[model samples]
Target: MLDELLARIEGRDFTIGIIGMGYVGLPLALTAVDRGFRVLGFDVDPDRVAQLNAGVSAIKHIPSASIAAAVSAGSFSATCDMNRLGEPDAILIAVPTPLDRHQDPDLSYVVKSTEAIARRLRAGQLVVLESTTWPGTTTEVMKPILEAGGLRAGKDFFLAFSPEREDPGNPKYSNAIIPKVVGADDPASRALACRLYDNLVAGTVPVSSSATAEAVKLTENIFRSVNIALVNELKLIYDAMGINVWEVIDAAKSKPFGYMAFYPGPGLGGHCIPIDPFYLSWKAREFEVPTRFIELAGLINNAMPQHVVHRLAEAIDKQSGRGLNGARVLIIGMAYKKNVDDMRESPSLRLTELIEARGAHTDYHDPHIPVIPRTREHAALAGRQSVALTPEVLASYDAVLIATDHDDVDWGHVVAHARLVVDTRNACAGIDTDKVVRA
Candidate 1:
């Protein structure tokens, strides 16, 4: 089975099945198809599958032309049916591993995907989980499910863990450029997974065990969460001392050796940084270990949205001679980070909730997001559409809050027309007017 799979991969004669056509899975499918391998994408969303099959991209950063070209080449397909799972020689799981309401690891999607594959399990096929999850999930949780089909892992079939590293809207990197990390309990499974990814990406880093590969992904995110929390703490301190944290970051980053700059924003956004660290923390409790640093970082990062609201209130009181009650405010960007339509863990929504609770009228304008969709937490704020950022629209608001630093917004126009602007992302840096205040 291993030799046959390797031969097909080497000859580029195999079909790659990616279960979950989300931010991670879509890019993987496109990359594999571009490399001359037939690719099949599976998703529970019938609308998403239909849209992809019709040559439309559900994600903003990925162009529809690319999807169209791949479909035209007869190498890319998407489906909601699980019966087609046996068609591919290799099935990769890139489903989401989100947190539940109690902040516990929610592996429901991963479990469902595994069960779907287990029902269709066959010999000579490889199964790789690319979800960011707890360390022992590949072996402890998925192994039992996959073996329920009466086939053994690494013998009848292959099993490995290779976490997906998809950074949306990052032009400098892609699936083909970033190096992949593959690990498995068995040597044959590790080699097969490495060979598969090495053909698609720039390189592959092999590790001793699947748990180590899972830890690698968590460690990378934990480092980011901690460093961001450090900067956010510094931002608070510097704000009290009347020093600009952005300027400090600029001067400190000039050292070029030991310092890496991570800017302070409204808060952490996107899927990985805000959520992946908690997976490790949750798993650590099994052995009675306390992740104090992760806990503190989570606390600090979680409080950033409230701090931004406080600053906005102070600024609005000083500028307009009124309290937050009935203050008309416009948020510049709604998408979590800059230049992307992904709002997975965006702080802007929480900030909006905070401001609105104080009787302030909240509206937003995002170039990428047309309307606020129903989120896991803020479903009540749905149906709110993006307001136009014309000069008249800017003048109508009491304060314009720059929650996200999207490249398309004209900060100069905002500074010139708005009564006041609270720049949380430091989007308007050099504008020296009193209307432009750094939050």
Candidate 2:
């Protein structure tokens, strides 16, 4: 069985099914198709399925031409059906692993995906979980579910964990180029998973166990969260001392060795950095061990959005000669990153909510995201259109806060027109503006 599977993978004849066809899954599916594999993208969202089937790319980085090419070639298709799972030689779960209200790991989506796959489990099929979650999720939580199908993991079906390392809006790396880490419940499963990924990606690094692979993904995010928090803390300190943190980062980045530059921002955003670290921290509590650094970093990163609100309030008070009450503040961007439309765990939403709660009228402008869905906190502000980025409109706000520094936004116009500016992303750099304040 293993030898036949390896042959199929090497020959690129393997049919790859990617569950949860969102940002991560769509790119992976398209990359597999580009690498000469038949790909099936599965998503519960009917709208997403419709969009993909129509050759329309929902993700910002994925080109519509790629989707059109794949669909026209009959190498890729999107569906909401679970019964089609039986056709794939390998299944990859890219479902979301979000946190609940109390910051606990929410495994409902994972469990649902696992159940969908288990119902169609057959011999000689490999299942890999690519969702970021706590360590042992593959070996402990998903293993039993797959085994309940009257088949064992290593003997009947192969299982592994390879966390998704997707950086949206980063042009340097794509799904086919990123180094993937693969680990399994046993050596045979590990080898099979590695071979499958090796056929598509640039490189595949195999680890000892699925737990270690899971931990590797979590650790990477935790490192980012910590470093970003460190820079954010430094930003506050430097601001108090009247030193520009961006200049300090630029100077320090000149070092050739032992230095990695992480810029300060409104806060840590995106699905991975802000949320993935807590999965490990939550799991650690079961062993009576507290992840102090992870907790501290999260605390500082989460608090930054509120701190931005405070700073914006101060700037508004100073410039407008009034309190936050009835003040019109414009947020420059709404996406988590500069150029992507993804808003999962975005700090901009939190900052906007904070501003609105403080009695300030808040509006945002993003070329990428014109309308934001109502989240838990921003439910009242749903269906709001993005404000125009013209100089005259920008001048109408009492203060403008640059939340996400999108490349398409006219920063010079914003600097030239806004009455007062609070830039959390240092978007106002190189612009001659006395009204600018950097967080």
Candidate 2 displacement at residue 294 in angstroms: 1.1
Positional deviation of residue 318's Cα in model 2 after best superposition, in angstroms: 1.3
- Least well predicted 10-residue stretch by lDDT in candidate 1: 430-439
User: CA shift at 204, candidate 2, in angstroms?
Assistant: 0.7
Cα deviation at 355, candidate 2, in Å, is 0.6
Model 2: residues with Cα > 4 Å off, grouped in runs? none
| Candidate closest to the true structure, highest TM-score | 1
Q: Positional deviation of 389 in candidate 2, in angstroms? A: 1.5
Each prediction's whole-model lDDT (CA): 0.93, 0.89
True-structure Cα RMSD, model 1: 0.8
lDDT digits (tens) for residues 1-439 of candidate 1:
6888888899998889999998999999999998889999999999999999999999999999999999988999899999999999899999889999999999999999999999998987889999999999999999999999799988998999998999998989998999999999999899899999999999999999999999999999999999999999999999999999999999999996999999888988888999998999999999999999999999999999999999999999997779699999999888999999998889999999999999999999999999988987899988899999889999998899999999998889889999999999988888888788787
Using alpha carbons, what is the TM-score of model 2? 0.98
The sequence of per-residue lDDT tens digits that candidate 2 reaches over residues 296-391 is 999999899988888888888887678688999998888888999988878888888788888989889999988987776457767988989787
